[model samples]
Target: MSLLAQLKILVVDDTTTSRLLLRDALETIGFRNISVAANGEEAMKMMTTSPCHFIISDMNMPKMDGLQLLKAVRTHKVFARTPFMILTGNADRNVLEEGRKLGLNNYLNKPFTPEDLKKALEAVVGRLQ
Candidate 1:
């Protein structure tokens, strides 16, 4: 649908498979500007150098983490209100609560479908008429 046309998206995940899967999903949904980060540390670096319109991150990673990244983003005035979505396998209540408090835009559990991703993006970007 090209709902994400020209919209920069930063996708952070530790697993190559997961990263590729998400990237492909976004592409299939017509997202043109998609970037990938292996972990939160890499994501932070990328975010600093190249700002993005949206960020979809995994909750767990080797260096830094989704929550840490979220906190950093919130503290940065430039990215404070940028849309951040957590895509995780872990569904811990505490984690979700923390994410909510940190101003996370949305949360999606693992094994999600293309529709799930589309819905989340729509929620953040608003449904394209």
Candidate 2:
């Protein structure tokens, strides 16, 4: 099977284009189960209903931010171990460090290429199987 087969990924971004681009990249990489959320609140709601194995989220968003969502996920017993990655434009070291403390699996800067996404997924999921 392809590396991405049957892997459910949740992509959270306030920008429609970002979500579309990420989704397309995942599809190109052979990921079949993919979902998108416009903001953290939506992502949280989705998480409660339909759990995903992986999450790629933006740090800055409306309603709720990536950190808040991450904390929420960590607090939830069902999602405590879920792999979460951050895709953001923030370059502040403090912010990155904070995210790291929150247990983010990987952090990718903005304008990331498809290869970057693939690499991050490989890093997070490759170890499992």
Candidate 3:
């Protein structure tokens, strides 16, 4: 089995389209164990129930934003070392810097391609292959 296939990834985004797009990209890269959450709150709940190896979360969400999720994960000993990748349409340096401070593995802007997602995932978890 591929190394990537062993990883259980959690994708958190408010939009159904974004979630589906991300899932397709991940599947294309040979990731089989993938899960989705619409917001940080759901993500957290899922984490408590079944922690994931990696997380891809949108920076902006209605219930709980990515930064807040990052903070919450960081505080939890079980999830502190899990790889986190932030997805955002906003290019605000301040927001990015804040995520950096909170220990995000990487960040990908909106409208990213499959290659962009692959690169971000590789940067966090090492070579996908």
Candidate 4:
């Protein structure tokens, strides 16, 4: 089996359209087990029970954002080292630096194509295949 097929990924985005787009892109890249959350809060709750091998989250969200989620995830022993990618329309240097400090694995700028997603995933967890 391809390595991507065995990995479970969590995708968190505030917009439903973005989530669907991300899901479709992930499927195209050979990721079968994809879980989605509408917000950081929802994603955090899901992580308590269903851990993911990788995480792709929107940088800005209500009720908790990507940075907040990253901090929370890092506190937990089980998910501290899980590869994490932040998706953002605003590639703010400060935010990127902060994410880096908190241990983000990669970042994908918004309005990205499937190829962008593939590249981000590749950077975070090696080649999807």
Name the runs in model 4 displaced over 4 angstroms.
none
- Our tally of clashes for model 3 stands at 0
Rank the candidate models, highest lDDT first: 3, 4, 1, 2
Q: Compare the candidates by lDDT and give the number of the best one.
A: 3
Q: What's the true lDDT of residue 124 in model 3? A: 81
Q: Which 10-residue window of candidate 3 scores lowest in summed lDDT?
A: 120-129
Per-residue C-alpha lDDT of model 4 across residues 64-128, encoded as one tens digit per residue = 99999999899889888888999999999999999999999899998998999998788767777
Clashes of 4: 0
State the lDDT of candidate 3 residue by residue for 28-113, as single tens digits: 88899999999999999999999999999999999899999999999999889899999989768999899899998899988998
1 or 3, greater by lDDT:
3
Clashing residue pairs found in predicted model 3: none
Candidate 2 error regions (>4 Å):
127-129
Candidate 1 stretches with Cα past 4 Å from truth are 1-3
Q: Write down the lDDT that model 2 would get.
A: 0.86
